[model samples]
Target: MKSSDKRKKRLPKPLLSDMEEIEMDVLSLEEKISYISESLFNTDDLKIRELTFNNKKMVILFIDSVIDNRNLQLNVIKPIIEKSAGDIQNVVNSNNVKETVYLDEALCAMVDGHCLLLMEDSDVLTYICIPKVMRDRSEPINEKVIRGSHQSFTENITENIHLIRERISTPMLTVKYSSLGKTSKTKYAVVYLSHLTNPEIVKTIEERISYINVDSVQSPGYFEEFLEDSSFSPFPQYINTERPDRVAGNLMEGRVALVMEGSPTVLLLPVTFFSFFQSTEDYNNRSLIGSFIRFIRLISFIATLCLPAFYIAVISYNYEIIPVEIIFSIKSSLEYVPFPPLIEAAIMQFTLELLREAAVRLPNPVAQTIGVVGGLVIGTAVVEANLVSNTMLIVVAITAISSFVIPSNEMSTSVRILGFPLMILAALFGVFGIVIGLMFLLIHMVNLKSLGHNYLYPLAPLDLNALKDTFVRLPIWLMKERTKDLKPQYMWKMTNPRGWKKNEESK
Candidate 1:
């Protein structure tokens, strides 16, 4: 051969043989191992354990990184070696065991936390399910609870499902798992109480999930955006929570939760505008106290979104509406400020947002220090320099505080952003602009749907019966029905919960 032809002949051949192209089962154990090793590019984590069962050679193949070695030995290896001479079916004690002759199937099994067994003179390959390494559950920092269970969902999908099952403890609770993402192949589960959740809603959730086509889905956010009915709406279509207790509670009331592998945050779907206002503390507190807190939260939500705009409107065009005592106090505060009310309020609000963002980015103790010190320094300096009004600073502080009062971070952020447009509108047309802006917002919400369910729920649809649990939560016994907005299969979740009390009264 010529020098050029000799080099081409000496070059390495492709790793995959013609058998793979033909999709034929390779019966030889050594060839199968070679195929897999080459298929994975001879990865460092590939492990092989060889043993003799009654003098018959057997090999175990797995990835060291994906599986728990101790679990594999205790649950699989012990049973097989100790119970030799019997069929593999009777010897292994693993949860799932399957035999396959196809190399592709065996490779997939190995990657999914399974150990493949190949015995001498046997063409069939057996795969046993092995425990996968997973992280332990910890309380979510963002959604803390004072009185309820502190456990939150972990990145492990199975453990998250187990937590929900432990709380509900009923066969009616259903979980359906489906793999998503073409490259990532992320696993996700849809959980709901079958007897309570509407089948149509479940179908809708599934259909929406099926529509997502992506290489990777890293968190619940990807699924949320794909599944949402309105992508442009500022309101979140799902309640993203990590607390298992909170998810269990929502499931009991006939909502669906999407749990994704490798993500701790679970998505509670078809939630309403009011649903964002609820907190886990609401149910833990006494009924009257919870109701008062809910009312305050709703009020604070309004103030968070409209306080700055309202302030701008009053000083710019509706100072006539101000009380005689308060008008002088406000006018005196604004006397030295050179900027218009709009510019002053905007600057203060922007500065507050910067401080808030800094607090989130810094370490906990440092963040607290910066928040307090920064606010005092900025507030004092701005007022003394006649750059911003004292009254405007107060409005910005109240607005920031009110935004924090919102339990859901998504809604809190959206409200903060929506304030700017309302501010512009108010500056242009004053109180009428605020009313007109609010009217358009209401109309949009009324038209918005979350997975085909009303976004504003009982308020927009005016379902009087469901209002009992909307603005204020009634006592557990009195609030027997599930919210109509969810369209739960069973409306009355409780009946005669107080029958014993009624019986005592009769006695």
Candidate 2:
């Protein structure tokens, strides 16, 4: 048998992912091309060009889909062909060029827009590639803010990193690249403040991402399910936001952010339950106004979860607790309805949800029309038909508005879903059932862990120092240290810059 034939016979029959090694000396140029072609399942877009220069045979291989043809010709082929007698590294003008003996690395590089260079009678293959950077500066549709930076994260990972880097220009700001999903081979980056973040926390998050053994990862949602400590908890363990300013703020507070390619939403981990209620607008406004807004949001959280249930409890079993006139009004509204309070509330709640969903799935202008027209027409028609009571409609409308007050959409949805069980409880045993449900909720939150940190941190564990910024937004100068629960490398974030105030008073 010929030497080339023997090398071909030794090639593995496994998939491309499993074929990690390729001995450059054992495989001739033709055999290497054939091996890669077969490993890639003989895809149609794979381009293989064979050229000869200085009496040496060479093959330039890359997928036509991802690589830029102009770059490959001008930076790689033109240089190599123009100067055929020297090392390819010094000759090629590509920004990121590397040489490796492993076929797996070459395959991955090709998928990521890098072209592979193969030569006969050599034990090393060269890589010629240019980084692709895309810029998108549109404001986020969901996380819009009135003050502060208007820029949001983009689908491109490089641009997302640039957004955060410009905000936090420090040597300690570190970003590490990784690949996930066996088939998709999607790229992701782990960003954190190396000096502020706990080393163990960073290591744990990276390991969890690496251990995700799946065929494909579509979004950060997939990773969240695998990374969260309590999968079934009602509260969100991570905050997903598209605003780069928000991400920069969290990183400054010693949190790790996961930025996935092709996704504008970045995942921030080890978050507290209170984190969902906080927003970038809070920091932009005056301290007192920000604190008041946060207070209202917290009240809304409670109202969203317990308002309907409270109404159900009062009408079903605790009517004596209400004023006589209000009770008469509520009682009269219920008289025309055939179902009980719980049933009446459920109908309106489901109807409101349908409207909300319709409004979301439709276009912006159409969604607004549907939301207003559909809600008013349906609400008025249901009340007039005696299918639902006016009192129940009012309660449901308030509940929906309260749910929308939540800054994080994930937490808002969870809070809305939680209301159903509470309503059911109120129907079963009235006020006692609501109390029991709330007790269980408190228990679950107390026990839940977000990447091993207390989900209710600074509240359940009672950290007095961290509380300076938890329930309320204090003046920026007042928060002298990072949250103690995170155990950040640098506990003191700042000293008293306002110490000069005392000198002014003395003068």
Give the best candidate by lDDT. 2
Q: Would you list the C-alpha lDDT of every candidate in the order shown?
A: 0.81, 0.82
Pairing residues by index, what is the TM-score of model 1? 0.75
In candidate 2, which residue pairs clash?
Answer: none
Candidate 2 clashes: the total is 0
Best by TM-score: 1
Per-candidate TM vs. native?
0.75, 0.75
Clash pairs (backbone) in predicted model 1: none
**Candidate 2, 394: how far from true, in Å?**
0.9
Weakest ten-residue segment in model 2 by summed lDDT: 6-15
Model 1: lDDT of residue 30:
80
Model 1 per-residue lDDT tens digits across residues 7-124: 1101112211112324233345687678767654454446898877756888889866456788889877887778766777777776588986666667666656678898876667
> Which sections of candidate 1 miss by over 4 Å?
1-77, 84-135, 502-507
